[model samples]
Target: MTSTSTSPSAKFLTAQRSELLSRRESYLADMARSTATALELTEDGANQDMADEDGFGEGDTLNVERDRLLVVASEAKERVAEIDAALARVDAGTYGACEACGKPIPEARLEVVPEATLCVNCKTGASLRRK
Candidate 1:
């Protein structure tokens, strides 16, 4: 394999790293906003009021909406962590290498999931093993 700095794949990986960093920032911001909103609602006793009014349809709706936002925030937080790991891999010169088999992960797969640590075949095999 060529030195990472001289490889064509290095350019693509560099771009991916930039994109991932931007996405991580967005996810962090979203998580922060969501958490703040949730905390504010909690402090204002909105959840308590909604719970007490559960007999009414409005409370149920509010509860469902709150749950959805929380879920979104949780997912964003998870993605941010994944992006962090991906960045680490990029810095370590292993961003596009499969962790399981040491093969080059396909560009298509990396485009869709830059945090992936396995090539398609290895990933499939691992999944099958799990079953």
Candidate 2:
């Protein structure tokens, strides 16, 4: 097939890339806020280690919340990193190409996941890597 991105595909990718970048920025800001809150609470001795409403200390509850928040924040950070990498690909003129097999990822897939690094087949293989 086609070696280059079609005009329509290129337009879609551009829009998708822009949307992903916006999402990445929002996530990064959220993560930074979460990290700062984590630090603040930690410094204030609010990191709790207990569960339950009244049986547990405030510190324990805070810790649990912060821990959960950290998990989410980390995932968001990873997404942002992925988006950044996709942006780099755009700059390098390979924005819509699959990283795994060097094929053009379908526009439909890219529209759904702007930060995708693999085409459908490659992505499926990767998802099964743990098996």
Candidate 3:
């Protein structure tokens, strides 16, 4: 879907693109940090002697933290992918249109979520369907 007269302005699109790029960079950095922390936790756990008095509980705690960090990294990676897709849409001249309904997404919504691909109604329906 392409933008219409009522769609976001060129300036708005440019700003959104810049914002998306910045967010993508941030997300990538977050992913790297989280992954590194998870790796460090894994290595630390591996080096600890299993026969220590408190080793079992400490290892379990480290494992939980490592798992949480992994999840954070994965979520950041997904956000980066979404930002990339939004940048592609900006380049393709479809940045402000809903991908599912081909409607002009409200500027307010775009302002809040530049990477959104669907209008609020479509997104709500999709979310419901997912459940």
A best-first ranking of the candidates according to their lDDT comes to: 3, 1, 2
Candidate 2 vs 3: which has more TM-score: 3
lDDT of 1 by residue, 1-131 (tens): 54643222767878899889888889999998887776665544565575675544655555666677788899998998888998998888778888888878877888888778798999999999999
Runs with alpha carbons beyond 4 Å of true place in candidate 3: 1-3, 49-54
Question: What is candidate 3's lDDT per residue for 3-39, written digit by digit as tens?
Answer: 5575688889988988898899899999999999999
After superposition, the stretches of candidate 2 with alpha carbons farther than 4 Å from their true spots are 1-9, 46-56
> What TM-score against the true fold does each predicted structure earn?
0.74, 0.78, 0.91
| Reference-based lDDT, residue 56, model 1 | 49
- Candidate 1 — which residues are off by over 4 angstroms? 1-8, 40-56, 125-131
Number of the top candidate by lDDT?
A: 3
lDDT string for model 2 (18-118, tens) is 88878888989988988888777675553233233463567677678778778878988898889899888877777888887988888888888888889
TM-score-based ranking:
3, 2, 1
Ten residues in sequence with the least summed lDDT for candidate 2: 46-55
